[model samples]
Target: MENFDAIVIGSGQGGNPLAKKMAEKGWKIALVEQRQPGGTCINDGCTPTKTMIASARIAHLLSRSDTWGIRNQGYTVDLPAIIARKNEVVQQFRNGTVKNLEKAGVTVLMGTAVFSGVKTLTVTMHDGSIRELTATHIFINTGAAPFIPEIPGLRDVPYLTSTSLQEEVKVPPELIILGGGYIALEMGQLYRRLGSTVTIVEKSAQLMSKEDPDVAAVIKKILEAEDIEVYTATTTEKISGTQDHIEVQLQTAGKSHIITGTHLLVATGRNPQTAALQLSKTNVTLDEKGYVQVNDQLETSCPGIYAIGDVKPGPAFTHISYNDHLILYKNLFEEAELSTKTRQLPYCMFTDPQLGRIGLSETSARQAGYPVKVAHLSMDKVARAIETGETAGFMKAVVHEHTGQILGAAVIGTEGGEIMSVLQMAMLGGITATQLRDMIFAHPLYAESLNNLFMTLEK
Candidate 1:
């Protein structure tokens, strides 16, 4: 039997940080994880995905070397090498996380932890040994799993989820992807750049349906130009496979079509990882969608138990999970009141011409009864964009017409993710448009577009 002041389940983004903070506060902390210490984002999700994207971007730039007067012969993508490098990166980070947790004086438990009773957990270790743990406070940050949707014949056919596909060292000749979100777009582009004939089927009206329609359309244009076929407002009717190929039946515009590919990757969204936690033993409540229900302070129905990250209902980004750690830290140790609503969160999509947005959209602002004014500037018009020979997107800013306060900003271009932080900070700090316009920004940079964007807004 082991006792601790706090027991954190799952040593991912949320659990690792929470355990470290509590241990630093002179509390005995037990960090429980069934798999690798770094969790999904470090292993199969963000790190691997971004490394693959970087490789894809290099391949893309090499293919476009003609524009720079460099007559490059044909290039080949060593898919196996790329996959090996990605795995190397994931392993390095995962090992680093394990070391950091140990240095923090956290007692790491490797096992499947289940609820034995209120504030009690029976951790079943890998060797079939059992250990009981009791804690005064418990944090559940089990994260989420990829959602595999049920399509007729999908179960029998061989298909890859996001996690499974990361293990592939060779690129398929023809790839068919279902679900048109960020993951699908990114992986589709990566494989397409590596010489795969990729096709994307999106059930929504457009790819990246969560973003503004205009932003999604611009991304679709860029993707089509890359020779990747995209079918929007489509449904995957069925799937069938053989040793060499897989056939996907898709329905779009009330018309049925079959597409054949050597590989099938499903980029559907995720669901909370709560099924194994056995929440019925505790007072914790879950919504219909299976996410643990929590108050604005991230507290579950049970006292002294909190949930964060994908297990709770909110955006499921790595940064958002880190922010949750901050909120939970304040509530637990700093004696400060914290809530999810108190933070200004932002989201980014890492595609060619990445898309990033913060706060309310223009449509949302208008619907919320704010008289909104929108200012947009094309990347082509920015001087630095012209100098860089990569000017194929735009920046849009939405503001309240009466107060000139920034309601939201969306950037889709080179360094869109970097430029978004300035706008995000402005919105979070309540900085008005006039303040942004008056501030002197560095010359001849991608971020200079912000000066032009805010200038267009009529004050």
Candidate 2:
């Protein structure tokens, strides 16, 4: 048995940096991975998908070039070139991660690990060799995978998950996506912009079930305006088809209907990649949904084991995953006290007009019994949006009614994620809606519209 000071399972956002940094501090660290080194975000999730989305956005701009008085013949999309570009970007990120880990003197083991006993792991190497390892601290950052629902014939027929779709060398002619969450919307819009006929199916009453109804409405309008079909409050009866032609039987309003597509994408949701870890052999606890259970410090029920990233129950964002490493590092090596409970949770939906959100929503604030004042502004009112002629959504903010504190904010328009970061800083600094209204912002910027946005709360 090879013993180490720490063993990190799954070289994900949390595990990669944690193992590297811990090893840099003269602690023996071993990072084991079953596949590529950089985990899902680098391989399939963010890096590759966003690279393809950038190409799609360029296609959209070219199609609408006439609006900007540029009269030119339309360009043809080179699908193979797009896929090549995405592969290049993913390789760069993966290579950078590997370089960093190697420079930090981390032992990189390419294998699958299962718990043999407390603080012990049996690693099955790629070449079918077995290695036993023991460490004082073990971290699980295996991340999440697409949760394929139990629709009839879904398994028998070939369908694409969010991960596999990015690798397609040819753009889908007719794409039907199951699930109307951010993944579905982003991928649908990405393909639709790339010249595909897109339809979205959601089991919930609305897309983005976590957002306020008004925010969801704006998102729906933005999508439908682009000729994308959206079906909410719908149930999938059956999924049956081959790769060339796929069919989905749907049930809505007591009626059954069918839709056919060249490609089917299942973006229903993601589940933590925890089942194979054999946590039962150890004292670590998991929730009812199979997510690892951890305290505010992110420590598992077992003393030296911790769970971070998508494996834990909280937010599944890349930034949060990286922060988890910082928290663990500071508390352990730097003698600093830190916790995950008090940190801000923020995420962005990278659709054409992005949706950036931070902190509480109006629904959550009201449900939490906060006397809230909601300030809202349609994108049309923003001078920058009107000037750019890309106004398609709105912005909303929830404030504590009595204390005038900025509780949360959402932006849905061009560069929405950047604008939301501006608001996040305000909220972090305890800047109130009143202060934002009176605060002098440079003229005609999307952010300057915040002055007018907060004015509506007074009206």
Model 2 lDDT, residue 263, Cα = 92
Against the true structure, candidate 2 reaches a TM-score of: 0.98
Per-model TM-score, in order, reads: 0.98, 0.98
Q: Tens digit of lDDT per residue, candidate 1, span 38-135?
A: 87889878999999999999999999988877888778898888998998998899888888888889999899999988899999998889999999
Q: After superposition, how far is residue 241 of candidate 2 from its true place, in Å?
A: 1.9
Candidate 2: stretches off by over 4 Å: none
- Writing each residue's lDDT as its tens digit, candidate 2 over 1-459 gives 999999999999989989998998999999999899888889988888889999999999889999888887879989899999999999899899989998999999899999999899999999999999999999999999999999999997889999988878888999999999998999999999988999999989999999989889999998998899999999999988887799999999989999999999999999999999999999999999899999999899999999989999977788999999999999998878899978887789999799999999999999999999999999999999999989888888999999899889899999999889988999899999999999998987899999989999988
- lDDT score, residue 39, model 1? 77
Q: Which stretches of candidate 1 lie over 4 Å from their true place?
A: none
Lowest-scoring 10 consecutive residues by lDDT in candidate 1?
450-459
Global lDDT of model 2 = 0.92
Candidate lDDT values, in order: 0.88, 0.92
- What RMSD, rounded to one decimal, does every model reach? 1.3, 1.1
